[model samples]
Target: MIAEVMGAICVLIGIPFFLTGTLGLLRLPDIYTRLHALTKADNVGLGFIILGLAIQSGSWLEVARLFLIWFLVLLASATSCHLIAQAAFEKNIKPWTKEE
Candidate 1:
């Protein structure tokens, strides 16, 4: 019972990070800011979700798989973000700046 409750709590905690990232993606002015918001929030959110699932898993093997999935996601997100940012830079896309 306690483990279930804790897992639920962890999942709940992760939800807001995902929402915040979505908000940032919609509201932020530039690609860099959006990527920053998305990658950071998603990484933390995914970590929390994986932790929750791992805790609720029936066996150590399941927990390990959860962690592996999380790691792969992290790796993929980082690589993709870097590639996108580099493409933007190569294309001469400037970050948004506040008007003076």
Candidate 2:
């Protein structure tokens, strides 16, 4: 019972992170800021969701798979974000500023 409640709570909490991340992607200026919002928030959101699912999981294999998926996504997102930002930097893209 406790695990179920906790899992539900975690899932509920995770939803807002995804929403805010999407909002940031739409509202923020510059690629860097958008990437920050996406990577950070989505990572946390997925973490919470995975945690919830793991808690609800009945088998060790399922939990391991969930964790593996999260880890893969984390690595992929971080690498992709870095590559994109670096490319933008090489192209001499300027960050959006308040004055602009």
Candidate 3:
């Protein structure tokens, strides 16, 4: 019962992060900021989700698999974010800055 409650709370907590990430993706002004918001928020949200699922998992193997999937996603997102930023930089796409 406690595990279920905790898992539910964790999932609830993660939902906002996902929503905020999507909002940021759509609302942020620049590519860099959008990527930053999306990647960081989504990663944290995914972590919370994975943690909740792991907590509710019936076996260690399932928990380990969840963690492994999370790890892979982290690696992939980071790598892709970096590559995209680098490409943008190469193209002389500047980050958004406040006009003084």
Candidate 4:
């Protein structure tokens, strides 16, 4: 019962992060800001979801798989975000500032 409750709580908590990231992607002005939101918030949200699933996992193998998936996603998102930002920089794209 306790594990179930915790899992549910974790899932619920993860959802808002997803929503916030979506909103940030839609509402933010620039590639860098959108990338920041998409990468950071989504990664944390995924972590929470993985943790929730791991809490309910039937065996160590399941938990390990979930964590491995999360790690892979983390690396992928970070690398992609960096590559994109570097590309933008090379192209001379400027970030949005408050004065603008």
lDDT winner? 2
Candidate 3: 10-residue stretch with minimal lDDT: 5-14
lDDT per residue, candidate 1, 1-100, as tens digits?
A: 8888899889889989999899999999999999999999989998898888887888999998999999999999999999999999999999999999
Error of 3 at 46 (Å): 0.3
69: Cα error in model 1, Å:
0.4
lDDT of 2 by residue, 1-100 (tens): 8888998899888999999899999999889999999999999999999999999888999999999999999999999999999999999999888884
Per-residue CA lDDT of model 3 for 7-93, tens digit only, reads: 888888888999999999999999999999889999999999999988888899999999999999999999999999999999999
lDDT of 2 at 31: 97
Clashing pairs in 3: none
Clashing pairs in 2: none
Off by over 4 Å in 3: none
lDDT, candidate 1, residue 24? 94
After superposition, candidate 2 runs with Cα above 4 Å error: none
Error in Å for residue 83 of model 4? 0.6
lDDT of 4 by residue, 9-79 (tens): 89889999999999999999999899999999999999999999889778999999999999999999999
